[model samples]
Target: MAFRLARNRALIAPAKSALGAIPRTALFYSTSSKPASSGQPQASEAETHFGFQTVKESLKAGKVAEVFSSVASSYDVMNDAMSFGIHRLWKDHFVRSLNPGRKSGGSPMAILDVAGGTGDIAFRMLDHADKINGDRETTVICADINADMLKEGEKRAQQQGYISTNRISFRVENAETLDSIPDNSVDLYTISFGIRNVTRIPMALKAAHRVLKPGGVFACLEFSKVSPAPLDAIYQQYSFSIIPLMGQLIAGDRDSYQYLVESIKKFPTQQEFAVMIKEAGFMNVGKGYEELTFGVASIWKGVKPLDSK
Candidate 1:
């Protein structure tokens, strides 16, 4: 079946079809509730992972929505407690690395920050463009599926004096579809610590490719596999032991935080995800990713091919 799909790949856009065309049975590991081996899963019975738990693919979005909504107000606080404020450094580095906005010979940027509901990445992008490059026209649309999260972000933007400046806007959007974003309109597409919660990552990648203008860049920063056997061991212990405790103490939502940690474990390794980026028709540099904080998180980037229409 995999071979057949590979042979027919020319007939379909690889990013759009990769996850949808493959049977869920072929894609994920099953628990004891595995379907019988002889037949395809009923459409309604198709399954995917929600953190470490198996769930109907259709329900994953709602579950994720609940998690984010529950954490919206305390999101920033939990981030500080859980990672000891290191996530801020990672984010700052991520934005500086991109150096968004008008470049040496480029025009002001139109950046779409998917799942950046709390405006962390969006605010940084605007600051980088305005403060670093003197590119005041660079604007960002911060999109997320959860309204409560967007509300928190909007409130923060208002307080930060961005709402009046028209440099950043928030929208309710699904990462997989981006229904309101126009085709070929974005100069850059970014998602930070957000893609793992998506129900269908390949579909999100396809949407990103669709919205980005040819030559536009796609950048993602997400929790990722740590390295060196010893460091991984220590990191795993800290994640499973300390994060949920911090969540309970700070946000009173231990389960959501636990799920978040598990989702990180379930995400693809850096190399595996880089291949997905390439398969989505984006051009990548060799290896295609860089690890930060000893691989606690990583950044991956790709560029839409100039020849793409």
Candidate 2:
């Protein structure tokens, strides 16, 4: 099945040239076998499109890792410049909604912040947990496929005094196959600004469901479809044109940032994503939208059923 998908992708490539040149990395998956490893696990067969190119279901993480590694040193600066610091607020809102309770109550909140480059979400979550729980232990694991990003995250965490003797840890792992995380362990699972890069979003969603405990909360912060037509038009213009230019100027990588914007537009809408969440064995899935001018970002929440055993 996976081989057929790869062949089909090759056949359709000429038709989708409108989408842009096929990434060289896309050709890495042309054969049924895995690509030469960067020491990561083998990829699965359930592949999805990364822009116009069809990559292996499993190789997407390695590609995403390369992108982050190239950009990691300048990632935070680029993020602030590109979003005008709005990304922080989006993350803040996501943490507040998690409602880390007082620690004296019981077991510390266990959170897996997937694709959480540079430990942004994990840092904020730990801060919230400490404030609310009063020295209660909150475990936040910052997981990403990019070693460079994980290293940067660790550096930032250390510089900011966010890492304690035992509060936060970093791992290089892929979201689509979170086999490293034990089932029914985490109280909350989060992926911010990262899912759009995933080639198999549904598989990632299913993995989230698998790792989370029953009653665990799943939250995501991602770029979403905008509202109000006038603002939408302006937002699209900025995303497609301005954002990549900013990336080039700030990060010295125009094409990567261009790919980033295209990937966001290719992502599912807030409504469609909610349905995917439900289909992944989550319940009561809901989404909250934040509109900045015509551009929109969203936080999606869902609960893993206690009865899902």
lDDT of each: 0.79, 0.69
Candidate 2 positional error at 208, Å: 0.7
Model 2 per-residue lDDT tens digits across residues 1-309: 000100101000000001011111100111122222535445555555655567665566566667778889999998898777777866776677666534443555677888888888888887887786574465677877677778888888879775655667777676777656777777778899988987678878999998787777788888888766766777789888898898889899987788788888888887788889888988744343333223467777788877987
Q: Pick the candidate with the highest lDDT.
A: 1
**Candidate 1: regions farther than 4 A off:** 1-44
lDDT of 2 at 75: 90
lDDT of 1 by residue, 97-175 (tens): 7787776665677788988878899999998888898987777888888878888888888888887677777777788
lDDT of residue 204 for candidate 1: 93
Please give each candidate's TM-score: 0.85, 0.81
| Cα lDDT, model 1, residue 157 | 83
Off by over 4 Å in 2: 1-47, 56-59, 101-104, 285-295
Residues forming the 10-long window of minimal summed lDDT in candidate 2: 8-17
The alpha-carbon root-mean-square deviation between model 1 and the true structure, to one decimal in Å, is 11.7
